[model samples]
Target: MKLLILLLAPLFVVLPIYGYQSENLIDFKIKDQFDKVHEKSDFSDKIVVIVGSDREGSKYNDLWVKAILDSLEKNNTGKHVSFIGVADLSAVPFFMRGIVQGFFPSDTTKRILMDWDGEFAETYKFKEEHCNIAIFGKNEKFVSKYPVQKFENKIFEQILNDLRKLFSK
Candidate 1:
């Protein structure tokens, strides 16, 4: 019995470390580029789509956004979806935050949450140097995560299909 317990102990430790576990979005209160506070409760009853990227991954965020918007439009589910942009700007120094913020468009109505301390990305386990897309159901339950290093048709189709299914539900 002791030998068996020892063998299973490693499995128990490793499973929690690397195994897949269902996670729900935590109740987070963060500010957007416009300094508007957003919380998980604000998006309740709507399918939330989170597009996150680090400095190196910023280039791919636009492509992912376009695809997500297109999918929502195609399904006619725009009203049911809440899009949230999260920029992982943890690496930017305090003094440089203003300079980085200046780079973002000033006229856009869309709000992009600035993750100054990387808390959001760390919680979601967002991939570095890749466009990380996470879809949550209306209940705020995590549906899926797609970390795209390069854009591809298949990947786009998969995202489209996922959105379609979620909307259908």
Candidate 2:
């Protein structure tokens, strides 16, 4: 019994023990595909919509990313919110970074963050196969989170509804 307990102790220490912690965003920084730096300070006065996927092969993740961005664009909430799409590109070779960047247009309104180290995933305690969203309210504090299980029109409506409430507050 003592041997089993000792063996399991390491698992407890290394595994993610809790859900997303809001305090982690207080001093976070991430670089976008264009190599522009974005930090907590840049989003201080606005609601930041972070859509992220830690897994490199989840098709649903890609679909959700596009759906979220398109919905945000259609809603025209640019004045009050910032959109960040984080993709785990850590497995790509350093030399291929330029090629990966080329896939995106030079002037996209959406800020696509290249999470080359998967730091944001660890920080947010995000699941590898799902699209996770974190909304930071004004003053750079965490507001709410949405775990996207599937792509549907209802999810978009829910997001817009939440935004309206947040903006009203």
Candidate 3:
């Protein structure tokens, strides 16, 4: 029994991490700030960048969302890519949601997706108290995720390099 338990314990730890690594993005559907529905297929054949906070109070909104938007807009990647901002709106009171939604930037360059119930964040296993960014490759598989304490030029460089590699493949 001890031998069997020892063998199974490793499986318990490895399985969940394997599952998270193998999960694809096809199961999600999100709405843009303009209320347009975008499915995972919309990102097919393109590298996808998802930037947002999984937290309740929109923590680090300025650092994560704004900096990513600025970086993407300024960089000339020329590679096919889609930038989506995810905001968990379930934290706000219902009455003020409309007002809060209106405050999302109306930039034509990128689209912000509203996650009302935090389902998207939950699905991606994002930390609930900090901002993070996820990169999905052209194959629609999750590549990597980064938790941001701050955004700087180096982060932008890494993102662009990843996009280039994805574009090449």
Candidate 4:
């Protein structure tokens, strides 16, 4: 009985546990098709442009989304931009490209955070649930939020201008 009690005591006792993972382990997370982990800390040192749109939006707004993706993928410009997707995790496995097809031409700054629950979007004040894009500064702070359905070239250009300012500083 003492032996059993001793054994059970260890089981019941709360002690330091090893190898626990964080739910928001942004660092070292693999992107869509790569053998790399997305590092969250990296954004602190660079400007990030995140896009989060899913479902029907991704289908109908493919062109516009692609344009954004293409812009991100441009030569030597990605270092200053990051994209975060706030969509269904299941869908991410299948349609990361559908959402990021053109936006990920390159990995210049590597600041993409895929927020499935829309927490980040909500915090950034984008409730349109369509083509939403936000820019985070080198301080790892959100500087702007732009929703797609209500966007004009001016807004996007303004976002670019904001990004340029971040770089300039």
> Per-prediction RMSD in angstroms?
3.1, 4.4, 4.5, 11.0
Q: Evaluate model 4: give its lDDT.
A: 0.54
Off by over 4 Å in 4: 1-39, 60-76, 88-116
Which runs of model 1 end up more than 4 angstroms from their true locations? 1-22
Tens-digit lDDT string for candidate 3 (1-169): 9999998999999876634433566466878778888787877887887776754534565666566556566765544677767887767787886888788778855567888876666667666666667888877888877666655678667766776677668
Error of 4 at 141 (Å): 2.0
lDDT of 4 by residue, 32-61 (tens): 322234556745676766565555444324
TM-score for candidate 1, please give it.
0.83
Query: What does candidate 1's lDDT look like per residue over 70-130, in tens digits?
Result: 7778767788988888999988999999889878767667688888988668777788999
On lDDT, the leading prediction is 1
Put down candidate 2 lDDT per residue, 26-57, tens digits, no spaces.
47577886788877687677887778775543
Q: How many pairs collide in each candidate, listed in order?
A: 0, 0, 0, 15
* Shift in Å, residue 164, candidate 1: 1.9
What would the TM-scores of all predictions be?
A: 0.83, 0.69, 0.68, 0.52
TM accuracy, model 2: 0.69
Q: Give me the runs in candidate 3 sitting further than 4 Å from their true place.
A: 1-22, 54-76, 108-110, 152-157
Candidates' C-alpha lDDT = 0.83, 0.71, 0.70, 0.54
